[model samples]
Target: MDSWVDGQPADSLSLKDRGLAYGDGLFETIAVHDGQPVLLDRHLVRLADGCLRLAIAADIQLVRQELLSYAAAMGEGVLKLILTRGDGLRGYAPDPTAPGRRILQGNPAAAYPAVNAEQGIRLFPCSTRLSHQPLLAGLKHLNRLEQVLARAEWQDSEHAEGLMLDQAGRVIEGVFSNLFLLRDGVLLTPDLKRCGVAGVMRAEILFQAESLAIPTQIADISLEQLQWADEVFVCNSVYGVWPVRAYAALSWPVGPLTRKLQTIARALLDA
Candidate 1:
């Protein structure tokens, strides 16, 4: 693993950093292959948009350059970029003039077991309900207590992911990825306006669907509707895409739509 910090080694972070105090920060986990960052521009766009939504001062170009440099050094791995509200006095209100901090870290890419991606993964429906906070709905910010709690609900190693529903029992997304279901030959993903991270891979798949003239819909999904879908898959930039073979007792095949999306995703990574 390799890392770079904006401050002194001992001054890793001050106790006054607002990010630690209030989760006032954002992060992006990117995939690096053959010394190149995958979907670099897309990740930057999302990161910049997140900073804007949080009112954080983040220069997209600077962040991109730093990420490229770090990724190049790491060669092939996972690149993590963390932007946080820099040091501040003890208070709930942020210091308007405080400088922000950026930390870039790189590590060997997480080795996803090939059989899981090839065959499929099992999912357990978590009892944790995602809270609807439109203000923080789509941004990948630091306040991830909901995901943490949801993930903790299941300790079974057989379960690769947990499906989380909204407070009203509407299917939202997975703990760390976007959810997409194939129903009656159409692709459907939950609307992110209510909750969940609007993942970069989700956006890429949506764009590819439009380019390929594949029918896609963004709507409010319910568990009952999901149970009847032809297939299910979860996606995130780091993990690419993986079909969901089983969610509780409900089962699905790795259908044509999933293969089509996977092909497109592979092409994007190759590009």
Candidate 2:
């Protein structure tokens, strides 16, 4: 499928686009199933919040319409929506009146071994650490050099995902997913107030847990805390959830809470 730029099919972006020049933008990678974007409202909410925080003058209603149209045409696969600050002048200052640039690219559904979800996966201890940026934290922004470097730390299939930490040695998330752990029947995830992308799936799981009367917490996680967790899992909007069996010297079993949430997540992505 061809990429769409501002509701029109285009193959190239302007050279002066702020997203290209200074990574001044936000993005959302959505999952399309049966011609509809899964978790569409949540994605939109996050995108809108990002635009508001970044002070980007984006017509979110127009972006929503474009996403629906694009997903309908795509039918199935992943849709990556890139919202740039439009073409800009030769410096860091952005034009206050410039409209946001919307780009939609479609790709085939992700293919991971079934064993990853069924049996469980190992976590590669990534040496690359996330930087602290409260203003930009939790927004799926265009700047992803930290994740790029973290992902590059491993190249083998032995580890299905890599665990990332902040410079302060606080466990944050995965290279492309959110991290969660179950301990004493309570679900706990890292607090993204300081860093990390607050993933759509992570938010959904938290909400689902709350509705089901399961205890959930968002707190600063340390390596010591993760070691004692009864169960560990990683998740994203596209891949749903995968139980984590091992990380470094620590290991955990697939607990009941993890499976319960996994079933909910699976239903959401497969629905």
Candidate 3:
């Protein structure tokens, strides 16, 4: 693995970086295959959008070029792009003139659980609930303590994932991926207006589903409603899409619709 910090040949970043100090940064984890990044444009767009929302000055072209160079060296791996508000003084108020710093790191993608892809996954309902914060709901910001804590609540290998609920007890998403449930032939996902990282793969799935004429909705979901879902799936850019075969004691098939979506998702990535 190799890394570049602000175009410099360095392996370590300043501990005083505002990102470290105040979590004032955004990041994107991209999947690379066959010497190309899957959904590169979408990831870049989201990163740029996050910069805009946070009042950070980001050079999209430069970032893209750096990512391509890093990917070329990596061959096949996951690329992590981080943009921080740079080092700042003792106060919380940021200096409007300080230029942001960018870091691009590449590492080999971890081997995924093969059985999960074929047979499907089993999930647990985590006791930890997500806090509602509209301001940080959709951005892939550095504040991930919530997910860390939620994931720590379980150590069982059989539990492939943990389903999280919002402060209102509404089912929101998984520990590291977006959640979707199928009910009465319609697909439903939690609205990110309250809290959750708006995953790149989630956006792609929603868009492709619309194009395929699949009925989909973004709404609040209760645990009761989720328990009745015909099928369930969790998704992220790196893992693509994984069908949830069991949640608690409830089980489901890897349904035809989910298989179809997975096909499209794989094709999109491999394209």
Candidate 4:
């Protein structure tokens, strides 16, 4: 097992840590291939942003170096890095002088069905609606009870992922991935300014789409809008990309745009 606590060899942490007490932390799930962490810069960028947003003091460059070393040791797997506002006394207030802690864990990458990318996967519309929290929106914070509750709605593997919506009935994202769709030749992804995680792969897709000259937009898509789309897909750093063939009663055929993004996604993930 590859694990580290605060750049040391320990595998355990203090019980009073803020991360454990109040979920005051952020994490990054990175895909490793051939001794490399994919999109490392992007991941670090998001991490740094989260740290700043939460007022968590950190040395991001040092953390990046540690991540690379830890990732290479894994050879091929998933690298999970957690940063928490070090342990503090019992209270809601944080101690500004407390240095943050970094916890790293490595595990074998999951082997998803090849057909998931080849043919496609189905979606389940989760009843758990995300609350409007602009302060925490787009940040991969430790608070993930909403996603946990939504994922608990289904037990079978019939649906590879569940789609979540905001309180306003606007489609937000998949349980663990960002959502996107192709409608009338335009690529549409849900706006995460109000909720949902702004994933690294999702950012790369937007950049790649611009270079590919594929029209793209970030909008509040309703369930009806998603149903009327020509094609649908979901993405995360680890999974790269997954085409959605069906969601509830609506079905879609994998279109040309999805295929193009899939190629780019795989390349980036394997890079």
Candidate models: Cα lDDT each = 0.85, 0.94, 0.86, 0.91
Candidate 3 residues 119-154, lDDT tens each? 789887888888999888889999899999999989
lDDT of 2 at 4: 100
- Give the count of colliding residue pairs in each prediction: 0, 0, 0, 0
Candidate 2 worst ten-residue window by lDDT: 90-99
Q: How does model 3 score by TM-score? A: 0.96
Best by TM-score: 2
Measured over all alpha carbons after superposition, the RMSD of each candidate to the real structure, in angstroms, is 1.8, 0.7, 1.3, 1.0
Q: lDDT per residue, candidate 4, 1-271, as tens digits?
A: 5499988778789998999999999999999999899999999999999988899988898899898888878899999999999888989898766558999999999788888888889999899999999999999999999999999999987889999999999999999999999999899999998999999999989989999898999998999999899989999999888999998889999888888899889998777
Per-residue lDDT of candidate 1, residues 142-226 (tens digit): 9999999999998977888899999999999999889999888788999989889999999999888778887899999988999
Q: Model 3 scores what on Cα lDDT?
A: 0.86
TM-score of 4: 0.97
Each prediction's TM-score versus the true structure: 0.94, 0.99, 0.96, 0.97
Q: How many backbone clashes does candidate 1 have?
A: 0
lDDT of 4: 0.91
Query: Which candidate would rank higher by TM-score, 1 or 4?
Result: 4
Best by lDDT: 2
Least accurate stretch of 10 residues (summed lDDT) in model 3? 91-100
